[model samples]
Target: MYFTFLGTGAGVPAKLRNTASMVLTMPEYQGDAWMFDCGEATQHQILHTSVKLSKIKKIFITHLHGDHIYGLPGVLGSRSFQGGDDQLTVFGPKGIKDFIEMSLSISSTYLKYPLEIIEIDEDGVIYEDKYFKVSAKELEHGITCYGYRIEEKDQPGTLLVDRLKAEGIMPGPIYREFKEKAAVTLPNGRTLNSSDYIGPDKKGRKIAVLGDTRICQAAVDLAEGVDVLIHESTFSHGMEEKAYDYFHSTSSQAAQTAKAANAAALILTHISSRFQEDDHLLLEEAREIFSPVYLAKDFWTYKID
Candidate 1:
């Protein structure tokens, strides 16, 4: 899996950064990518990257804020022009469905693919499949915003080739049956349980991505023990009061949440445009409270290990 930040500026677009937008690409999902918070000029930012508009299968809107969703309509419309025929699903807070529908209708934009919009009314599991599960929790923001926790399902263990060989089972097409079926019958008429020849299961990865918010327990809960915690750092350390008044988090506050949640790593994004040259101050503040913290930049991609 890899996280590519298309834009990371807060509130408005800047010369150095656009607005809030990122793509989570999963190799297991083929060419499909999941987008989070498509702000203004997001489609334009995608133009500078290798991410294809037609490959975006899902969009998760953090809030109804213009800075977080202004580019959504454009992105949705452009996907049609880019030959996107696969079904696309969008998950967001209440009123999101109305906003998308109104924009598309008013602009007379028709999609070539099936569109599914799910407005979240409560916090809990919003999406689940055989490979992964996604849950949401309300956060402390000026408006109703949410943080998402994505957990990949545990993978089955590898086939124990050495054990099978010890049992006189040579490598052959029958080895495939041992891995897929509960039991495999040998040529000698002996049936062997597949479980006995498999190693321990592999633990799956977890990631938490939060919208704009103040320091809150819900943020920590959503990020608990996650492999990566992507939190908004809209202000510097000394601007705690200003950050609280604006219903946004400071760099230190974001790090505090990460430390409290015991997150393996932290990626600070949604940077304010005011600190054009002093953005490093935010990174320094976060590192004081949490280790392995990163400041996201536009077009920068981070691979999840």
Candidate 2:
């Protein structure tokens, strides 16, 4: 899995940053990607990266702010023009359906693929499949905003090849049967349980991606024990009052939340244009409260291991 920041600026597009947008690429999902937020010029940003419009299977909108959603219609329409026939799903707050529909309708944009828009009125598991489960919780953004948690399902353990070899079972197609079946009967008429020849299950990774918001309990809950916590840090350390006034979070507050949640690492994004030159100060503020903290930049990609 990997996280690629398409645009990380807050409020408006700056010379160095665009706005709010990121892509989560899942190698296990056949190269499919999930987009979070579609700020203005987001499709343009994708042109500079390996992200494909056709490969974006889902879009998760944080809020209805222009910086977070203005590029959504363009992305959706362009996907069709690019011959993306796969079904696409979008999840967002209640008014998102109207915003998307209105934009596409007024522009007379036609999609070549099926589109499903889900307006989240409450918080819970919004999506689930065999490999992953996505849950949402409301955050303290003044407006209806959300934070999402992506939990990858645990995988089956590896087959004990050495033990099988000790039992005189050489590597062959029959070894595949040991993994697929609960019990495998050898050529010698010995029945062996598959569990006996398997190691412990591999724990899945968890990630939390939050929308623009002030420090809140919901953010901590959504990020609990996450391997990666992507949070917004719109201001520096001394701007706590200003951050709270604007319904945003400071670098220190974001780090505090990560520390409280016990997150393994923290990535601070949604940076304000004012701090473009002094961004290092923001990073330093966050690292004071939490270790392994990163300040995200546009087009930067982080591999999740």
lDDT by residue for model 2 (1-305), tens: 89999999999999999999999998877999999999999999999999999999999999999999999999999999999999999999999999999999999999999999999999999999988999999999879999999999999899899998999889999889988999999888999999999999989999999999999999999999999999999999999999999999999999999999999999999999999999989999999899999989999999999
Clashes of each: 0, 0
What is the TM-score (0 to 1) of candidate 1? Answer: 0.96
lDDT of 1 by residue, 1-305 (tens): 89999999999999998999999998777967999999999999999998998999999999999999999999999999999999999999999999999999999999999999999989999999988899999999989998999999899899999998998888999988987999988888999999999888888999999999999999999999999999999999999999999999999999999999999999999999998799999999999999999999999999998
Q: State every prediction's TM-score relative to the real structure.
A: 0.96, 0.96
**At residue 170, what lDDT does model 2 achieve?**
95
Worst 10 residues of 1 by lDDT: 24-33
Model 2 CA deviation exceeding 4 Å by range: 170-173
